[model samples]
Target: MNTLNYLHLDEKRVADVVTALHLLLADFQIHYTNLRGFHWDIKGHGFFVLHSKFEDLYNDTAEKIDEIAERILTLGSVPSNKFSDYLKVARIKEISGVTCGSEAVEHILSTYGHLIGEERKVLDLAAEAGDEVTVSLMSDYLKEQEKMVWMLTAFSSKTCGK
Candidate 1:
């Protein structure tokens, strides 16, 4: 394919941003799965509440995952979605076994905090490298994660009080 290049971007910088974004996507996939699991397994008096919340969160994650992957594509990089790829790239761990609704809420809060930190780092790197698109994408993601962290933390504190 012969195409005239109009935009000049640093290949190395783009690669770095893509790498970081891929990692973020992987982490989101794992978190999305965890949310679904919580939605499925949640019980007790808070079942209705926890189920609804988890579904909403995971649905949003699904949408964000698509957007992140598209941003990676815009940077001329492929978005990885294989299970092995996610397992290798994700920094977050998948929790197993039974836990209460309150525990699920706490888990989500902690995960959201972790995501916020990771996204902040990615956004800073993109900014430093002049990758405005990636920086903007990460900034939006960070805001959403922060909101989730606050909401989940508030729920755990108010309802569980633990």
Candidate 2:
């Protein structure tokens, strides 16, 4: 239909996927800020390891943010760009001034779990809409993030809540 992209997906379903992607974009915006804060603020015994690790994580988060926004554009919608908007819609909240490595890692774990959940939601909608590009994007994200969740949980010295 006229509402569909060149990909010829169901317009209504694609709209649902686009909405989900916008929420995911908001989550990543807050997530990126949190990662940056943890990278800059982390102190104590795990500083050397966690500081570098958080830096890596934030870099990855930045890429994800760009990818998500571009994906939203491809889906014929605008990504949410305002931090105030991000704060309002993001399930992952912005945290700051956290100097403890384990505490920050704990937050990271929680955030990753939430992100995976949201990605799955998007993935499902995309699949329903036959938007394989978005589906693949979410699938790759889910795989890597699930691995990060495992590793972060170990670094936090916690059992897998699963």
Instruction: At residue 138, give the lDDT of candidate 2.
Output: 93
Model 1 lDDT tens row, 1-162: 111133366767667777888888999999988888888888887888888988999999999889988888777778986978899879888875535898888888878888888888888888877878778888888887787777777766754534
Off by over 4 Å in 2: 1-4, 158-162
* Model 1 weakest 10-residue run by lDDT: 1-10
Where does model 1 exceed 4 Å of error?
Answer: 1-7, 158-162
lDDT of 2 by residue, 17-130 (tens): 989888999989898999999998888897999999999998998998999999888777778778898888888877999999888988988888898989999999888888
* Clash count, one per candidate: 0, 0
Q: What TM-score would each prediction reach against the true structure?
A: 0.89, 0.92
